[model samples]
Target chain A: MVTEGREQERISVLGIPSLGDRFAVFETMVKEHNISLVTPPVTKHTLSLGARYSPEFACLPFKGILGTFIECLEQGADTLFMVTSFNACRMGYYAKVQEQILRDLGYRFKFLRFHSSEKGLIGVLRAIKRFSNNASWPTVVSLFRLAVAKLRALDELEREVQKIRPVELEKGTADRLYREAIGAIDRATSFASLRQAMRGYFERLEQIPKDAEYAPLKVGIVGELYVVMEPFFNMNLEIELGKMGVEARRTRSTFFSEYTKWGTFLNALNDEKKELQKFAHPYLKRDVGGHGLESVGEKVRRAGDYDGIIHLAPFTCMPEVIAQNIMPFTKEGIPVLTIACDEQLGRAGMLTRVEAFVDLLERRRIGNILR
Target chain B: MRVGIPRALLYYQYYPMWRTFFEGLGAEVFVSSPTTKLMLASGCSRLIAETCLPVKVFCGHVLSLANGCDCVFIPSIHSVEQKVYSCPKFIGLPDMMRATVPECPPILDPDVDVNTGKRDFYQAIYKLGRPFTRSPLKVRKAAETAWQVHQTFQRRMLSGLTPPEAIEGMFPQSVEEPEGNGSHPIFTIGLIGHPYLLYDEYVSHRLVPQLREMGVKVLSPEMVERARLRASICELVERPYWACEDEVIGAGAYYLGRGEVDGVVSVVAFGCGPDSLMIEVLQRYAKRLGKPFMQLTLDEHTAETGLMTRLEAFLDMVRRGKRPQGISPPASWSQRGGSKRGSASWVYLA
Candidate 1:
């Protein structure tokens, strides 16, 4: 098929796990590029598309991606824009492998990387213009605005995390408000109203009692930082635990970077000083993987405080993987639950697992005042 | 004076070093053996049910070493950089293991002396060496020599050289790739997994050959350069917070998007942390690109039949250009997709 004057080119894009309001960015990019956005149908078929190609041990995200591509094929998508990085972990080379596999299967698509983005605004503008071909300049501007709005809103929400974490209000209540606010923002029109809505939401969020007496169990959520912060990405997990009457105390939050960084090393010296100031305890040594702070947290919890501990993380996080290798011998012998959440957890299943975790905590421990 | 070492966590990497280090000081080092099914099961039963697999494995090793060693060595490991963390269980392990296995033996968890900012590791070693010989200087000398030996060994491992070679004074032969018959659909498949799992024949159930049967070539991270991997990542998004896991994810995306390799397989130990995030990210990327990807979460109890069945299905689907037998994925996919070609004449070198 010979294309005419402006070369009416078709381009396709894929969506990975929601990194918060990135869709607005894509929608804008599509219009600016004069590209028709073809979202692969997300169904059991798409998952099988991945299962057919992916190794069985891979988590749900791989399957979800494979599924999307098959859907795109059925929808007549031509090019697949793959964006990612190589550092941090293993997902960097994912696009290349998937592309090869898709090619082998006779699905033809042009693969483009965002590598050219680093060349500055000119390079970015040139690439966008290359894709946008027939699109008007105003169209590109509008798209950028949408992307900007989405990013701004997400950045604002994450900054207010202190309102939801431990030493603040009840864990679940703030999340409840946050989710409600986000959902409302989706339908909101005026930017002023969205701010007011978020404010109103946070205000109500403060109303949720952080100090709930006689809660059945208090648990600590510790693990890799990325999965900890993203609620939808991790399955609305904290809120689910709360509904079961479990007072969740997530220790790892965005706010504690300074403390976690400096304090982690200082903890060893501090523990020694605490020991020296008290009785000459012979065996009061630091524990496995150099986490004396957690040992102290365990002691505090064991002292009629939190009933259980929960370690949450992504599967590949090596450090946490090492840390998880050890924690069985706390003073309290506290029952600990380790939960790993990935993109595969679609609300219902995650809530069920969380519910079960809470139930397990309840059956094992007695009600505590601090919880 | 037996210094007990729990055969868990860094025991995979540090076992030989710590054992040799302690022994060099003339203190008998008693390292625990691998935790077996019985020990792991017992630990699982004892600990909370919600614990990650590694934590369960650690509990097993701790229980296994409880009565066997004089003092179980629990190190207080901290991140060397910002935003990095050792597994959460590690933080509370010394205390937790101490409480759980109280009678196993006395644990050695020496915190740093604030005044000197030194851990009891050297001091404790010096004290333990007293029984071997009462010379304080001699003990210090032995400790220093032992530390030097350990540092050399560690440096070798970091250099991608086998740790065992540092001691034996001989490096292993080059990693040989099996000669392949030239054929269509050449795939340089990237395999993401823990070194233990990738190297362990028993655990992975000989996954490489299984893929090779379908003409898929495997590339482990150990085989690639950091530069090559970094070059493939999409620089459009913000650089990820995690350097290591992000590299694998980004590299996999890079190669997969290159239209060179057929597919990428992420084999993970069940409950391993980095894979948790990486697998999700890979799948998300694949979804966007409308590509095929899979992750295998393996545990000690990974069944060969289960693995084989899944492998066969995935291979079949990749070759057949459709979902394989007994496999029906999500009926549709995300409308948001990855790279695609506008024209049929587009030269995609796959």
Candidate 2:
């Protein structure tokens, strides 16, 4: 525990981009608790610092978290609060691994995880209380209320994008609206206020025009759903593809993909277990981790409705790798363009692939279908 | 109308078994012209989003026979192990095929475990065969005899003869050796995937050595031939309906378990409906056993460089150990083998 008389000093909370979402919560929470918040830069160095020090098979999130922890520790953030979940994916225990990895780096920051105490309202306050030691109840309550509001707003606004973005008259307009809605969510103090702010953001967002013409090429986004739906995960490929003038069609929505892909996570039903097939690619073969996004992608292709396919998955994800191999068989005649990204991805490079893929699709469209 | 068996996958495992039942029922059988491009394309096109590419391709081949035959003999996978069977996708395949393909009568095996055994598979065939003739008893007898011959022949093949020659004495059989062509370094590729993915080379486009063009030889469990692979079986119970997937993976496990393969690589369908349950165990074996390995996922959009680059990198890691600090490891590897530090052999793909 920190010394009781450690000046009640102002400790700044620092984070990398993945934690950028938590910045507003941190700003308000730290203030109420007489602390400060600092967000670090999203840089190649941030990634290298992580890539240089993580397990080879660890997902990109691990790398990003490592960078955040390092940046914060170096910047004198004495205490770090990690928010994680009981996800069906292995990432749920990421905090434990990250904590171990960070400690090995010899940083003396106090790691306060949300789960070590209560998982809900009462638990969060207790962890904060124990961590801060000097914080009062009222301050905790206010911080809790603000954090809850921000988290809800973030989830609500992101979900709302799926509803509006796909149906919007403009191609990229809903995405822009999503950004604005997120900002409104970040600043929101209450549920009612967040809803009001979100409505206004959406209204204003709808005013922008998204000119998505069929453009002779319909590019279907395939592979693991995590990278396809999550912008932060795949470096905003959908928007980039939209800008490249290609209608990027993805298979699963975030809600269903994340929730259902890991349906048998606990194996509670005592499902049929078989001998593990040793594939050339363990990372690519298992469909259990992610929603059968690879299967979903293949099914979409076999339906034979698209021009080309774009597969996006995290670096070491197995199901996506397996799907990537069998895809050639699924779409025997169609041109397929696959891309995988991690936190280390450069925006320009990813865009280059999307651009090239679109170019190929367009050439095929005009050269064969149109003629 | 006759059903065509591809003589692949289940046929190898259950042909004598399935044939006795089909022939006893007086069903004329025709298998595909081996997994050629046309049948593969036909099978590939017939698959929907819910199935794996190999299964999808199997459907394509099944559909190829559907037009000329009375029914496509793709069974409803109700149970693989008495009751707690194979993957749910396999169980629902006949339904999926029935829904996806309209003009075909999907010959199904509802449940093939104990009480509802191989006879159940034939029951469906008998039901279909009833449209042509009467007498399920005659069908049963024929199925049993045909199965006896098929099993006897299967035993011969497992005794280390070619698949064709082993059955030659049983019927007017024609056996031919697969093209082993040249004496290339038997580049050990760990065909680590579900049975369907490994054996159904039509779907796993990476099965052969296109990657080997860059100097790699392919090694897979299926390529090892079941006869020579008996030593790979870690555990056994005399069970006819052995999870074909288990056996296939057992074949790969045997390959890696043998410890002779230079570098092991795994290729799986992007969303393997079945391997989901199986991979956890395989990973424990691979990761814990410290096997030199790489895994590549196949789906509609897997990139050439990414696959080749990963393959090359795994081979490189096995070959060079690691780069000597200055030379950059291949950009494809997200985490470089940590500055030539790893004890295992995983080098730069480049």
Candidate 3:
């Protein structure tokens, strides 16, 4: 408060494109906390940069985050925010190693990490206060509430998009509207306007003409959070499935569910995760980290609902590797296709695998109908 | 009932306790034979390509025990100490075995978490013992006796004996120690890694015997007291969460800093998360101490001849009083520098 001519530091958080306009809400929150916010869009070049400097065997999310951090640093962001988990997964080591690598590479930026488990809320608050130059708690808390509401709204919009994408008569209509909805949500400053913006997007999505006669094939997607949520990392799998006339349904989204879990103390009462554990008990007795157990649970729970399942994980991900190995023996009739993605994976190869899987599913469905 | 124990992973370290506990419950203990080529092949066939070698070998051992045992004992040990975990594979080993290995016997997995107080510990053991005996009191007595045996076994290992020697010493009638002990060796090398990687002769290509034949003494992490090893790693920037890896780091740092051993070799399974980070930390510390450090990452494709050659070269360097300095050369250095004359650089297969 005493300083007159001091410049405030710019803060940046890595954003997944599939989260749509949810990141814009985060940006608004940061700005409200009296800090400059920089949102660097994840691109192919970002992935390459992250992979280039990261350890060869590091998981995909680590490489993606590293790439984003490097890009943010280049864009004049003086502070970077990251989240770490305390689970058995490799995520706990990612922040520490990435910071070491970043420092070794001679980057001059403040690195702030928030623990995803026990100290989730406190860690975030402390980080925000420090990064935003001692912003008042009341301001931060209010902005945080707004951010959470926006995330929930964004998740609802995305869920609707997933439902309508497969049955829509005109392809890409749902995706385009989602992008526009994100922009409107981002620009809406007040609670009333935010609600209006969300309603507008939902109405627009409903307007997209549906194929009444077509019964789209439903495929459940489950895996590590980064690969499952981010389109580019998984080769735009959801959109591609929609283009193939298959509906891609995922249980977890990056923002609403995960954000709420981490941003509040409600994680301890997570009944859904408890139910997943019970379902996965027969296959995976323990949480091997990442979404390994959850992936198995999702498949087992929705085996009858979805025609097939697509299990995606980064190369060398231990937990998912365990899940992938166990998935073959689930006794559920649904066929599962496991794809391990890394930077080296080519788009053509991914498409071929996906296309082949869809063809197999289609053939199986036709054969079942004939029988 | 015959309880099958796979002689892999934590078996080298905790076999005595497991054996004693099962026997106390009136069950016959049948340990899988030493890792063999066939077992490794069987493991590789059952597991995914991305899994580490030790896990694959473990699956092989499970396959070997399929026909003979009534139930396979695969403990899902979550934490041995407060905030210290075993590898994730250990936690999920039982489930993985049940999924991959067909015709496998019923698995006996009692969740072990030392962090959750002694009551829970006894409860886990009591559950394990329920199938054998109806009385919970008998299970408690057996668990106590097993604990005592394990403690004695640990003490025996700390007194400069290998895991195999300690196991033999614990159960005198069960195993025989080879004759002709050499009074002293020309050079001593600190061999550090998880017990399974270090003690599994097939995985390590009989590393201890190979060193012995070469007039070298091999010192493993087991030789050091657990408390001493714990103290050694206190200065580390981040204490490793994996209990076994933490011990390896502790013992490795202690030896490297004390300059007691001429060289250090870390035998790790390929794609192990804990080992990779721990080795990196050890490498940095070793470099600071100007000691020769080599990390041998074993996988399914590991060839005996190539491993022997590297071991010989490393031992030869130690014999010549040549201390390695700075960063170690990459694995490709051997191929590239082989054509050049008078270049003695060897590859560190990490």
Candidate 4:
């Protein structure tokens, strides 16, 4: 340990994986530390880069993140961060495998990963200490609080966008506003500015001229996290559904809420997971890894609120495959459509399937009134 | 009462114990027939197209046993060792069966997780025995007997017998062991994969038998000593917490590093969650060691001729003693690996 002082005495240029629009929050948090964040927008080339080197059967998220890492490294990043889990999910091994792959590709980068749930507060603090470059505990704590607040505000804005999108009087107004709101949120660095942006966006989203008499069909989206969150991966399913005048709600909590639920020491026992397993008891008796239990449980829990359920997953995703297989047995008395996406998935085919599913739900709703 | 067990998945690994436990409870154990094209086809018809091949085969076996027994035992094995988890599909196997195979008899599904704690593990075992006996003593005795049989089976496997060869006590005598072509020498090749994939003659397309006929000696993961396997696993920068880590990563690393085997061949079912990652790990190790590595992915659509052709080519390479030269791994990391002394030293703390 004492002999490698030369190797250990380098500046750390940190790279964080891209997932949705959460890059804004990651940037704000890491900016205060000595580590500089590499924010790479996931492009078509990124997906191709990831898929080329990644194992043929790994999930899309792995491919996407690996591509992002490669991009970051190309942009002069020396350290990369990833979140791992200790469950039966393949996410746990992502860092290890990706590290090996990157190493074999001749990159000399530092890889850091932790099971966010198992690590708890102390683990997070230790991890922060490593990347923060000796920042005081109080400063780190405040920065962490800001990151949490920013994440919550972003999720709130997203939820509002989903609601106003379907019933907006003008076509495409809601989506246009959403793109602008995301940019505003990303630029707001201070707490006061972030709060102002959140309030202003919420007001703008709410005032999107709505048709008073329109009753949009409501659907719940559930499945693998990456596929559900990344619009490009799912081919903008929410925006497409909104264009078709259907309201889509995400049943899976955002990653921020997920962190609060599982990353804290208090929630280490996984009461939420146990509760989901309970709701899924009659169909799925245990946690099937990933969001599978929640997929089944949310359907059972909120079957009455939505006209239908849409299950989206990356191809060959284990837990989501289990969820898709078990969704039928739940027999929640609602139409359920399972769409498995991969690089080979065609946007046209996906849209046709969604259209047919929405049509079926519409007919069912009208038929119920006739009865 | 008759209890049905599928001759697929964990059945190859735990048939002895399961048979003993059911028979000790005074019930006749009925095992479904080995995998066949027809059974796999029927199973495939009922499942999502993306399910791994083994689970689909298990589903087929369950369908075949629909009318043959009073109840079918499908244990959801979550974790066998502490801090290690089985495949997600395995944990949800019972639920998959419940949803897909409606015609099947009542399922006696037990949740098995020794990682959770010994008490809960025993409770699950006892619950599986409850319908047959009310006395707790009978359940404990049956459980003890099952454990003894399982350990003996593991010992037999460790003694270098494949599961089928050990269980039946009959090795397939090669009609003629082909001489390694002309100037090439016979080689010892390490075969690593899940027991279900490796031992199933139909799924594997008689890989072990074919390798034996080629005059090549085969070393499977089961044949490796437990201590050596554990030690080899520690060599990994981070130990895989997968329940079957020993079968793939540990065995592959041992063979690659120890130079006991000429080359390592891994058989992974297409779309397997853990194998997809572990195979990559093995490939990297093989690259680092300059050992020839071939990954054969089996699926429902796998052709027998293609498998045989690949096997013959791989064996030929091993016979000639050609090192597979591919992409070089990170030089800095490998140099660092040499200096890192212990298992705990490689956690990559920055």
Candidate 4 per-residue lDDT over residues B1-350, each given as its tens digit: 99999999998788889888888989998888778999999999889888899989999999999996999999999998877888889899999899999898899999989877989988998899999999888999998998898888889989988877665542223133332322333778899899999988889998888787777788899898888887888788456678888888999898878656777788999889888888877776765555677899999989999999888877764554432334333455345444212221121210
Q: Residue pairs in steric clash, candidate 3?
A: none
Chain B TM-score in each of the candidates: 0.63, 0.68, 0.90, 0.87
Candidate 2 per-residue lDDT, tens place, B298-336, comes to 765555566666665666666543335466445555353
TM-score of model 2 (CA atoms): 0.47
| DockQ for the candidates, in order | 0.12, 0.03, 0.50, 0.64
Estimate, for each residue in A1-371, the C-alpha lDDT of model 4 and write its tens digit: 32466348433688887767776556645665556788687788888999999988888888998999999999999988888878898988899889989998999987877665647677777666666765678876766666667777777777888888888888788778777876776667778998998888778777888988999999999888888888888888999999999999986354454555434443533655676678889889888888888888888877788999998888888998898888887767678899888888888999999999999999999999999
lDDT of 1 by residue, B168-212 (tens): 342123234543433643455666655445544444676765666
Clashes of each: 139, 50, 0, 0
Candidate 1: lDDT of B193?
Answer: 57
For each of the candidates, the C-alpha root-mean-square deviation to the true structure, in angstroms, is 12.8, 12.5, 4.5, 6.2
> What is candidate 1's CAPRI-style docking category based on DockQ?
incorrect
What's candidate 3's DockQ score?
A: 0.50
Weakest lDDT window of 10 consecutive positions for candidate 2 chain A = A268-277
Q: What is the lDDT of residue B61 in candidate 3?
A: 95
